[model samples]
Target: MRTNIIRDEHVTVSYDVVNGWTVVEVDGDVDLRTSPMIREAVIRLLGEGHRHFVLDLCFVPFMDSMGLGMVVAITKRIREHGGSLRITYTPGPIVRVFEISGLHATYQIYHSPEEATQRTPSPDGLADWPHSPSVKKGS
Candidate 1:
């Protein structure tokens, strides 16, 4: 899988696609400054017919409310189009936040991008693939 770093400060945003699944990896901190870049990338990918996404945030130092909001918004957009979003390789802090806010239940949390991409969508969902786990979350 190829990876691209878009912006970097105390935080960095990178994205890559593998087997039709776009994997977004966020390193450092994801605060107000870098969240917009992440949002834009996801939107662009969606426009390009990439419905399935795996957001890997294992290296992220922190993610504020805005960052979380962006994720939720992207998930909503994908769902509106009968698509799905999966979050994998998230760090403990981010996972705790998602769990506490009940967002974890709303979005599928996977151990790897491959698993996330292979998940079978619901009856009203878009598509699915054979389960082939290949995503590595943390460093």
Candidate 2:
């Protein structure tokens, strides 16, 4: 894993590439203050031929509308180019926000970065689904 830090006045975006996945672990607040930087970093990785992404939001304290918008925008961009975004290890508060806002339904959420990176495409082969046995029917 290789970590890259993109620091600014209000927030810092730390990312790493492991195996074939680019895991972007975001810290600090992601609001109007820092969404652009985050977007740029993710877009750059996509431009560099990274099709799989794991966004680890375990350390993020807060994410506002701008942050949510950036995520949606990035997801759309990835889909346009036949890519995917997996959010993993997000804290309860952040997870709640995503759930409440319906973003969780639009994106794949995982318990850990490793799990996210290891996920395979769903039956349709266009989206990702949980690999755990818990996802099985009648388990």
Candidate 3:
């Protein structure tokens, strides 16, 4: 039942545990000004012993390379710690960024946080999916 919320003009990061997964929902733009904040929050959580993470980016309207790099770094750090990171609820523009950078394939993405937590238990485990496919409009 641990929950933490951090807010600023550029972004808001909130963390909670859901169904044994650590859910981090981010709202607002993620750019150079905000990505550091996200990194700090996530790193702090990692220090606190959180492993499984679902990052919901549905509310993020825009992101730049810095933001992407921060996410990539976080993912690597989590993996190095024997943890997993799933990105959920990505909006179209962000999805495009992920597609362009081939991060969609690098990261396990889902339509919702619940799905991100539940879907991998399926037998296929996303191995059948393509790498960085173009996101369908309205998806």
Candidate 4:
């Protein structure tokens, strides 16, 4: 089930579990104005005992440095608490933001929720689920 914590014109933040991982879907622009909502949503999920995450940013049309900062900060928080974060974004401005900021290499980013869900998280926070057989090692 999907639970929405907040929604407005600028952004909509909601989350649900997929393959035992919390999938937080952001369906709007993520900027200085909207980043906090996303962050707080993740924080709430974390409080609910979620340790694995997939940040689905496919719907985000735009993002700024502040948004990137928020993502990094959120990642740190999750890792600090012994959790894992996977990010997903379409090939567009959102990808551009990560590439320009040189964060694409830092994140376990994917193009779709299906892709993210099918993969394993970082070594420390490995999920109990098995990754897709199609996934080649060290790809």
lDDT of 3 by residue, 1-139 (tens): 5455678766788987876678898889889998988988988888999777888888889989998999988877776666767787656899899889887776677878767665333223233233442332223
As a whole number from 0 to 100, the lDDT of residue 125 in candidate 3 is 26
Each candidate structure's TM-score, on Cα atoms with residue i matched to residue i, is 0.75, 0.80, 0.81, 0.86
Q: How far is candidate 4 from the true structure (C-alpha RMSD, Å)?
A: 5.0
**Among all windows of ten consecutive residues in candidate 1, which has the lowest summed lDDT?**
130-139
By lDDT, the best candidate is 4
Per-residue error (Å), model 2, residue 6: 1.0
Q: Candidate 2 at 49: error in angstroms? A: 1.3
Local accuracy of candidate 4 as per-residue lDDT tens digits, 1-139: 9888779988988888888778999998899999988888888778888878988999999999889988978887787668877788888889788878877766667788888887555546523212322232224
What TM-score does structure 1 among the candidates reach? 0.75
Scanning candidate 3 in windows of ten residues, the lowest lDDT window is 119-128
Q: What is the lDDT of residue 57 in candidate 2?
A: 81
Error of 3 at 131 (Å): 9.4
User: Global lDDT of each model?
Assistant: 0.67, 0.71, 0.74, 0.78
lDDT of 4 at 122: 54
Over all chains combined, what TM-score does candidate 2 have?
Answer: 0.80
- Worst-scoring 10-residue span by lDDT in model 2: 130-139
Off by over 4 Å in 1: 118-139
